[model samples]
Structure formats: structure tokens, C-alpha cells
Target: MAADRLALALAVTIRHDGNGGVADDLTAPEGLTDWVRELAEPLRDALDAEDFTADTAALDAVRELRAAVRALFARAVRPGPPSSADAHRLLPEDQAMARLNAAAARAPGAPRLEWPDGGAPVVRAARPPGFTDADRLVAALARDAIGFLAGPERERLRACPAPRCVRYFVKDHPRQEWCKPSCGNRARVARHHRRHRTES
Candidate 1:
């Protein structure tokens, strides 16, 4: 259970990194993910007992899987779908899912997928000023809709009610109404105007 939670958090953070760049703490560093490296060693040991190899080919396979998982996570926080560039970046792996599935078939007691694949949907980042990053990110977001997430902190997933600020938030009470305190006061003033106007 701890492993599963860790994986979930790692996946979410990795997804936010979007090909890696140092930014807010919510993101990770560029290059091979440390969490992945940490998890890989243990995973390898466990799988090895089940006949998984430590051969060069196996190492490559694990890296590929790590990449796939990382890519899968990024779409969740990306503002838009992946662009053409993103598609091209992930093309090889896109072509390799069937193969990954085949390998998984060989493993004993496969992990439950929890979500329906519904097949990887085609996204176009090539029409009129296309960018693969957007398309890829969007596609990833769709996957997130069904993908495993650390049980959503419902209290932290509120949508701001301010007309000018439809932005999302990790914390906002329904009664809080607006995204910001100013917006909340604005609502109050609006209500006051409506009430006084009607009284007049």
C-alpha cells in the first residue's frame, strides 16, 4: 500500500514536470528521475526472483517503461493537449504499448490496471500552428480522468467562483465563493447592490 501511494505521488509529480525543468517544488529535476531509480532497484530485485533479468536488454526495457509512466502522468497538469512535437517525442513508446503488454503477460501476478484503456486516442498537433506538447498534454489529461490518483483531497480540489477568476484551486470552500478574498468581497458588494436596488 505504501508502495502504491508512493508510485501515485511520483506519477503526479512527474507528470507536472513535463519533460523536466526545475520550477516549483511540485516538479522534479531534469533527466532520469530519482524516484524511478529508487523504485527500479527494488522492483528489479523482486521481479528478478520471479526470473526477471538484470541484462542490458532488461535495463533498457525498464527505462522504456519508466518513460511511458512519466509521460502518462504529465498530461494531468498540462494546460492543454500535447502538440505535434509531443506526439513525435512519444511516438516510439506509443508504438510500443502492445509490446509492453506482451512482456507484462509474462510476469507473474500482473498489477491490476484499474482503468479501461479505450485505446490511445489520436491527437492532432499538426493543423494550423500545431504544437505536439499541447496535444500530448491534453491527451495525458484525458488519461488522468480515469488513471489512478491518490484519493483526491476533495477539500483541496475546489473551483473558484469569481467570474473573472475561473481558475482552479486546491483549497476553496463552497461558501468561500470567490477564488480570492477580494473576489469574495466583490460578490458581497454585488449582492448588496442587488438588494438595495430592489428595495428602492
Candidate 2:
């Protein structure tokens, strides 16, 4: 996945549970393991092994990073309302930035060049020695979040306004409004109901 997409993926891990409540995908070690495995392609550079597992500490660390990322995401969507799940509970902007930077610093990486036969040269982030898997994971996520926030995609970020939804998405087109088609439909239905209630 690309940097912007990876950051968005992490942000969307906290979303509606489809039953009028928010759900956290990274609430458990198993969920964290599954999430990492699912995004293994984009996270390949950060992971030291294929069979990575999460412990309590790793889960807690990643959750803290996610909160920071979400807070920054909310800030990125400036003037717009944040996701309803934790809108009132988001960390202060400065604190969030500090936490994210600290996480990224835990696993500092340098760029490395690679060239293959008859192929163009490519640059990849080379992980330094002695960092734990958790450090790498959190750092990778923080780095991606930083990249997304500083990149062009930050302008397109928006929080879904549909009822019971709490997701942030990058608008794909000029006319796009909600995070997904379902959210759009739900928002429209909610509007209709509100209109009906007022008329009654």
C-alpha cells in the first residue's frame, strides 16, 4: 500500500460496529496480529519476520500510536468535524505530534538503494539493528502518518458524517461527500428521517 493509504488504513481501524456503536479492531493481540498480516505488503519493510505475533506491550504501544494518528487525522481535516467515536477525547495536537515523533524515533531507518538486472534502481527504507518488532511496527505506522499528513492527500481527508459512523476517508473525486457509498446512503436516509420528524 502507498503511504497515504497505509495511514488511512490505520485510522479506519476504529470504525462503526454496524450496530450503532464504535468498534476497535486493535483491541486484542489476535486482532493486531491479523491486522499486521493483512497489511503485510505495505508493512514488509517494518516487519523482521513473516510470522509476527503481538504481545500485550505491542498491542498497547500500537494503540497509543493509533490514537496519535487519529488525532492528527482529525487535525488534518481542519474546521471539519472529527469522527464521532472519539471526537471529544482526541489528544491535544502538540501531544499527539510528540507521541508520533517519539514512536518514529524508536526505530530509525535509513534509505538504501537497490538495483536488479535490467531493472531501474529503487530506494527502500533500511531498518537499523537492535529495534524490537513492536518498535518497528509503531515507527512504520508513525512515519506513514507523518508522510500522509505532510503530503498532498491531507487536503482530501474528511470525516464521514453518516449516523453511527466514525471513519475518516480521502475524497476520491470532486463530488464525493462521504467515506463510502453506504455512508452516503445512510446519511441521506438519516436526513429524510429528520425531515419527517420535524414535519410531524
Best by lDDT: 2
Give each model a TM-score.
Answer: 0.31, 0.94
Scored by Cα lDDT, where does model 1 land? 0.36
**How close to the true structure is residue 192 of candidate 2, measured as C-alpha lDDT?**
97
TM-score of candidate 1 against the unseen true structure: 0.31
Model 2 weakest lDDT span, ten residues long: 1-10
Candidate 1 error regions (>4 Å): 1-45, 48-53, 74-88, 92-96, 110-200
Q: Which digits, one per residue and each the tens of the lDDT, describe model 2 over residues 68-132? A: 99999989888999998899999999999999999988898988998999999988889787988
Best-performing candidate as measured by TM-score: 2
How close to the true structure is residue 142 of candidate 1, measured as C-alpha lDDT?
26
Backbone clash numbers for all candidates listed: 20, 0
